[model samples]
Target: MDDVVQAQTGTPPVRGAEIAVDGLAKHYGSLKAVDEFAINIRSGEFLALLGPSGSGKSTILMMLAGFEVPTAGRILIDGVDCTRLPPQKRNIGMVFQHYSLFPHMTVADNVAFPLKMRGVGRTERRRRAAEALKVVRLDGYGARMPSQLSGGQRQRVALARAIVYEPRLLLMDEPLSALDKNLREEMQLEIKRLHHELGITVVFVTHDQGEALTMADRVAILRGGKLQQLSPARELYERPANLFAAGFIGEMNMIPAQWDGAALTLGTGERMVPPTGAVVGTVGQGAVTLAIRPERLTVCDPVTPDALQATLREVVYAGAGTLLIAALPDGTEIRARVASASLPPALTEGETIGLSCPPEAMLVYGEEAAA
Candidate 1:
């Protein structure tokens, strides 16, 4: 608990609270912003609510923080119903994408405001403020005004203020979205370190897949106000439940195919076998979509058996690897990522090639699944 201030006298350490959201729903007139949302977040775990804009992730966060009332359902924290509680009474900390620091206040004053609101003594407030600043790696900058700090520093200040009161749960709404690439990556590590040291249950909301995958213990993906899938990062990437989950979590190439229970037939009359334990919805589905990640494809000789024939169309040079764009016999584009050093020297544009994809690496979804 390095990030937490030591107990004073007889005070006990703060423990994280478990959160359970059951049938949570929000409606604005006829608009259903969030519907039938449910998940149980374990104590001391980091969970990410991931989705694109208008997917209702932000609305869910607002409801959880008690800033918005749900149209139906309930929220329980550590077995206590808090669905109707005010934000101040919930005892939860929140950090927003924009650092919502008081520009008129010094860093220390900003961090101490929460304690002051609770009517703590001045001396105790200052001591806890200093300790919180130290936890955020800004020990000597307490006297500086918010305007004097950089973006990342200001965000850290906001984080310090949110946690200074020792809240058992923390909610971050895309807190790193405003930072540059390098700084965002740096803060992600810092947030992870703080979560480990504080043992606070954190619920992070973001639209960036990379950020969610990098920092979350588990990720819940939402689309159109509905949960697409909830799983660890690796499982979400390798085994998406539907077409939207497959397309949203990472880059995927969807190929239209016909399914006949035992095998799939491509438009080019090529018969393909499904991977063992493939998640094809029922045995008798007619039209299906085959999903294969670019990284799962391998380029082979044109004459290779049991391989899809393609014509190399373009070579994209990325520093660490190369992206090969090819066209199948039916004109469907296929993409393959290969290490730069592993690319064949003789491969060139407009040359015939064979693409091999293991059945186990492929995902099949029904054609009617939401995109």
Candidate 2:
């Protein structure tokens, strides 16, 4: 990729393009797939568009790749408008969920296919294909067919093919969704390394929270085709902007409560000090929802002073800790995580237990949190 990238003495050049999307929307008749979506992605930054099914994550990706046209708004790459640019002319590479390798072509020929489209000579295509294969660590496997390689290897070939031309941007639409747990994780690191080495801007799409949090420099969360929150993974996890974000990012126990800014009254009518936690979202008055992480809660005897009372419904032993599932008086079930060694051996289902959390471990949201 000599012509593709300029090597620095000791650092990677930012060969990626900065992108801007403003008022981007897509509509299929009455169905709005994306609504006023906007974001700014810096050069060489790895950004993940994360959301559940039908949340417009893929819609935005396709628009960026020029495979889908927007009903409204504009896309700018490197300060130039590309909203109407053809996919082939955009110089954007994409790797899909399925490894779309050519079954009839050898690995070398598949990698060289893009170059051939641009009318490169046969000799030069062969040389470039060999170099691309080496970068993906498939140097000698180039002679093999796609059917002969494992799923991971085929995916690697697809990646090499995408980066072989060193496009300014790389778009991945859940590329590891087909792999098993172990291999998916392995590929995450592999892709991250490649992004660092190649310095290419990447817009990754995934519904898996772990994958988004683990690999992205920042994550843009979406729901029902609208952007919910965009922030660094840690900020998104620890300082969620709203109830939906607080509940979606990870496992959270939302409890019904009443708050007056200084104190909180539980659903069971027990009064306690309000959460002194770092507040990130709107904390409303009257009926409210108190949110806490399962890992931050402690399970104890019902007689424990100041602890909320609950009936143990089940116990789950995870590798690092035990999960305590309990229900409050109103039948609202919640979870708590405790070190396995600390669990009371005599505790059983139907036994009354106490749940407590430090003031700083909670956040208060409106009653809509229950919905």
Indicate which candidate wins on TM-score. Answer: 1
Which regions of candidate 1 are displaced past 4 Å? 1-3, 6-14
Q: State the local distance difference test value for candidate 2.
A: 0.87
Query: How far off is residue 139 in model 2, in Å?
Result: 2.1
Reference-based TM-score of each model = 0.95, 0.94
Model 2: C-alpha RMSD to truth? Answer: 2.1
Per-residue alpha-carbon lDDT of model 2 for 1-371, expressed as tens digits?
Answer: 66333432335555788999999999999999999999999999999999989999999999999999999999999998999998999988899999889999999999999989988899988888887777677889989999999888999999988877768899999999999999899899988877877788999999999999999999999998898899999988877777888889999998887888778888788887764564445666787877889988897767888787999999888877999999998888889999998877777899899997876777777764433
Question: Which residue pairs in model 2 clash with each other?
Answer: none
Could you give candidate 1's per-residue lDDT for residues 121-229 as a string of tens digits?
A: 9998999899888888999999999999998899899999999988999999999999999989989999998887788899999999999999999999998788888
Checking candidate 1 for backbone clashes, the offending pairs are none
Error of 2 at 348 (Å): 1.6
Q: Could you give the C-alpha RMSD of every candidate to the true structure, in order shown?
A: 2.4, 2.1
